[model samples]
Target: MFKMLNQMLNRTLQRVSLFLLSVILMACAGTQSPNQVTVTGGTIEGSLTPQLAVFKGIPFAAPPVGDLRWRPPQPVTPWQGVKQTTDYGNDCMQLPFPSDAAPLGKTPAEDCLYANVWAPKDADGTTPVLVWIYGGGFVNGGSSPEVYDGSKFAQQGVVFVSFNYRLGRFGFFAHPALTDEAQENGDMLGNYAYMDQIAALKWVHNNISSFGGDPDNVTIMGESAGGGSVLAMMQAEQARGLFDRAIIMSGGGRSLFGDRKVSEATQESLSGEQYGLNYAEKHGITGTDAEALAALRALDAETVVDGLNLAAMFNPAQTNKPTWAGGPMQDGELITQTISDALQQGNLADVDVMVGATSMDIGGNPFKDKDALFASFGEYAEQARKVYDPSGQAPFQVVGYAVGQDRTMQEPARYIAEQMTSHGQQAYYYRFGTVAQSSDNPGAPHASDIPFFFDTVAEKYGDALTQQDQAAASAIHQYIVSFAKTGKPVSDNAAQWQVFAPEQSNMLNMTRNGDMQHGTDPWKARLDVVKAAVESSN
Candidate 1:
């Protein structure tokens, strides 16, 4: 037994070393250097990898810090020097992530509005573009995730772009402090992050052509919050022409406007004031007047990080807060009332769309029984249990969260298809049902589709995978790349996906076994509830 244990340990270490080696090679490859190119008369420095020209840390907009903290994204101030496009820019200010988000490299800073672009190393000046938005419950994550590396897409003759936006309090918080009468120039309310996204899209529209990308054929893509942002941008009339296509993965956004944001702001302000008062006690500071706000801001970023994380845990968006707690605000400026309402109406971007969700998202809510699921949700408990009967051997918490995911992602994507079909537009929907072979988990788990989508199983999560995994990864990667280059996301090797329309809502349901037919409406019943909520107006 001891010898067996020793063997297992040895293998683990070998795997670890190989993983580190792959990462190091990739990093060094990212910096080995490449020739300079001029896009839009502005030179962009890039690196040459196996088959791609990688440009990292391209400033799409001026950093939103100091005076620009809560302000909308401003235009990028061009520089004369070829800004070394190697390192990733800082992530926008957000609460620290431990519970909700996976650990990426730490880059907690306020000056975080930046972007990166990847294009073919050897290509003409008119490839399609795919702009990616990272997700972390609107409170964490950035454009710098390793999984989102655009090198692959670039190699496939598609221009891939990623950028940073504010998260959590810094991005969505709107107090009476920032919303005075003077700031009423169409940027009056909260969700500056959304504004940042719009700004980045605008930047792409104006500048992508120079990067050998087709400005007219831009596609906005993302997982989770980024996916939700795609929907939001589609709805906003101002953002209609920014992109012609979209791809959403594990789109955690069920509704455009979160119910709990304003109230959460009120709570955060009160909490901040309390923390400031306590801080004043510790320090030889004066009274708890307006100076407290300054003092809180002046506090070291590290000192306030823990406080912000705790405060975020109380927010409704963080999975533990009350259901109607903080989330995307319905402020008229950032979001247009609600994304659902906009979809229902004909006021969304006229573009080809592909939207889907994993079987389970980031939350691992154990669905042990109905009582627990109901206990977690208050009034909606019975309604949730009815759709997801968790009375089986598996916990109801699992079923409840599944239904909740539908409420959050599946239904909305279906609803978008429904809305698009209603408007005589072509839309496609998918459900990633493949579970990681590593674990006995349920259907397509949260963000599990990302590796497949990016075709980076070996690059990202290679630990649990084996030979079969690489083949599957290759197939999925080709599907997404084909989609980006062309409007259709199908390949001879992958599943045959169908467009979503009223007559036949035929869609692809990807699984470990293979893609299956899933044209049936998965959310007709749940949508009825959403409609009732909107109409009840209670």
Candidate 2:
């Protein structure tokens, strides 16, 4: 009987030990150093800093390499174990700029279909999400720059995301053979970069809730090419309902996908299918059939990029001719029509939009001679000269800069806002005029508003930042955060931002005074003449 009692006591002790061990494990898991979250494909383990939880290099799509080089982004295969997402992935392949000036990561490769996310550590899955698209004229750029760090946004209760897409020739190339093959497979072709973006959006929509983000409340924002991309995605049929709002900075409306009229009229132009055939022929990869595609794909990525002249790709004057190529084709599938055409036809996504440009976005005018520049306006030349070169003594460069700013950035942005507001959609407009504190700095130049918008002034300008700069950044950042959370950009400290209407063209002009105020349209007559000139040309 004593032996039996001792055996029972031993069994009881074992049960107690097992229960205590499970309790210890539960407590330890509650305080684990790194955080783990399961997404669509698999579970991801991310690092936790003092400020935010950062998950980098998470694959949203399979790598576009080898036979998949020019195809639409494919889904990532599911994985079994937890994946450690610690560092950034490779940036999209492109020619390198100076290291100090380069906005890309250390390595750039074709296998670069990854995204990064930043979220508050204590988030409970209801935070608003902001997905950023970087701009390198659609030929370069990635999500790896220091200025693009999302810690600030995360601290303000936002889940920030950035991703890498195919760039340059790899992103936008098209050919007849490829189109034929796509038709056989019941797939659309061209605009692979945009396709990659759509895939990323779908991924985010499916998996963002795991990162404490609300899939229903997403804001898509971009500058320059990225800004244009916002418009593109808004019009893309495949991207419907992916985002609820958009922020476009320095993005052109009519010229977003190249001169649509020109591309359509000029059979041997930069953006159509003929241009693709010409590109293949230029590289001695002849034939308009499957063999040509085999030859084109056989050539390595570097060889394809090496054969093209970088200068011609960037210079509008050069590309205006039939010899050079351009990015973002007007293929009927991905980009059915231009942004202007889409907006006019009421085919855009019905989402709230905030659009703006800096004071001096494109530098001085592109024309060399004053007479030639004004003469392009034909009957409106006299009025243009009076409005743009009012002094008649202002240097051609100064006049050109003013005209270029109006033509390229300011006018296009205002036109988009006008169109949106006219359609009974909420639209907001602003003019970013906050110049950095430096003797060399002119008025806010192209892309200057980026640091301010991202609240990375200190990271970009370091010791040169003034208190006023910091305040401006804070105000702008707060405005964006408010917009992301609520449809309207309402902040306690900021002036009440008015919705843009066709009758009253008021803008929230951001100046160095650390105060944002409403102002009337400054270049009404100039933009009117500019718009007339563009319409007449078309």
Candidate 3:
């Protein structure tokens, strides 16, 4: 009897041990990981890599569809359970550009007001935040491009964020009926794209703390149209206090229209309201009433986009008449004045800025031939040719392109830096001239510095990436990261960045030999002529 009792007791003890082990495992599984965060909408769980915790496709606002079309972004609808933000949401609605440098990862759709985040796995409330705004001429870019991945930034102890805004017609449409609706509700009119950008920044200001980012240390950065948006944000009354530092890459600081008509009903360019009416009439929908708006909203998203993108906008055959609003205009509440006007008046946000452009960039007055282009400079024509086409043997297209670069990109970058410096704010200017080893281009073309700034040259060049490219990317990326951490940009791998001053005209140039050189701008004399021509015209 004693032996039988002993066997039964042993079995009971073994069962109890197994049960205790199972309970411990279940408890561990129930504990929430750092990857799961509670935001304004609800609890969201993100996927984890070895070095970072990444969250994508978090809705920052309601879908601008149906009745909400052409209106300011609305608050996101709250959810009941943990939302899995593992994959990227759709990019803003538009036809994809065929030769785009940064291709979209997800399909384009109207419901694309989503925000993404990349934070250190062990992030603890002290990391600085960097918000990225993409550029496709205000028409074609998105946050889902692989080259825009912020893993390296996260690994460097910073929280990186990117969000999608409306693009093309879907982003910048205006009409008589829409204006009526806006006025009735006291809503701001036109420039809905800027409104979306402001909304996303507001969302970051409110929610980034939960992701272990310091809300007070936010930096906004963009390239091209995105850079233009940053300039607008600096002067926008509603956008004040939203960001502390800004980086403008190839965003023109001078007036875009130059002596051309900007917002009057003219054969060259129609006002936003007139352009909207023209678009509505073409769609077989006319009138300035609620019914007209309903019909406009009822149109399919694809129809509204109407095959618009960066290329289509510039194609003369497609854009003989103004179809879209052309982009952001003076919407009194948001954009009170032109960016150049704001800078001249010193009516801008008190924040430090880092502005720059590629060696070869896009810009120039519209002219039929090189002769006409040079003549636009009036008495400065000979000086222009002397600096731009000194050989006098270059092709018309080459001279035109270089002239455009000076007026639109190179000079404007220097102008913005000069203005910010005058405002008693620290300004840093750079000129990226390092030609990628895989390319045969004469100089760094427009938007080519994006991958380097984000430290994703490997993704950009793939197997063709060279050691020189890697070194260039590392140096530029370090400057950006250092800028985000502290207002001053310092790179241990490169030379010390000096503050820009009118007298010194100091700038950091990423040379073709893959060296970072700090000195006066190489094209200061050329830029001075361009500046004089622009000033005379204005």
> Tell me, what's the RMSD of every candidate?
12.5, 4.7, 3.7
User: Can you write out model 3's per-residue Cα lDDT over 1-538, one digit (the tens) per residue?
Assistant: 9999999999999999999988788556764666888787888989999989999999999999989999999999999968999999999998999999899999999999999999997778889999999999988999999899999999998899999999887788788888888989999878888999999999999999999998899999999999998998898888888899999999998874222222345454577887787788889998889899899999998888787788877773454556677788776677777788889889899999999999978865578887898898988998988888888888888778778898889988999999989989999999988888989888898889999999999999999999999998998899999999998888876889999988877899998756999999988888988998989887
Off by over 4 Å in 3: 1-31, 257-268, 318-321, 368-370
Over 440-537, each residue of candidate 2 has an lDDT whose tens digit, in order, gives 55567777788788899888878888888888888899888889888788766888899987667788988755578876767677888888888888
Q: Score every model by TM-score.
A: 0.77, 0.89, 0.92
lDDT of 1: 0.65
lDDT of 1 by residue, 140-175 (tens): 788766677777777777888988887765666544
Ranking by TM-score: 3, 2, 1
Q: Which wins on TM-score, candidate 1 or candidate 2?
A: 2
In terms of lDDT, the best-performing candidate is 3
lDDT scores in order: 0.65, 0.81, 0.88
The number of the candidate with the highest TM-score is 3
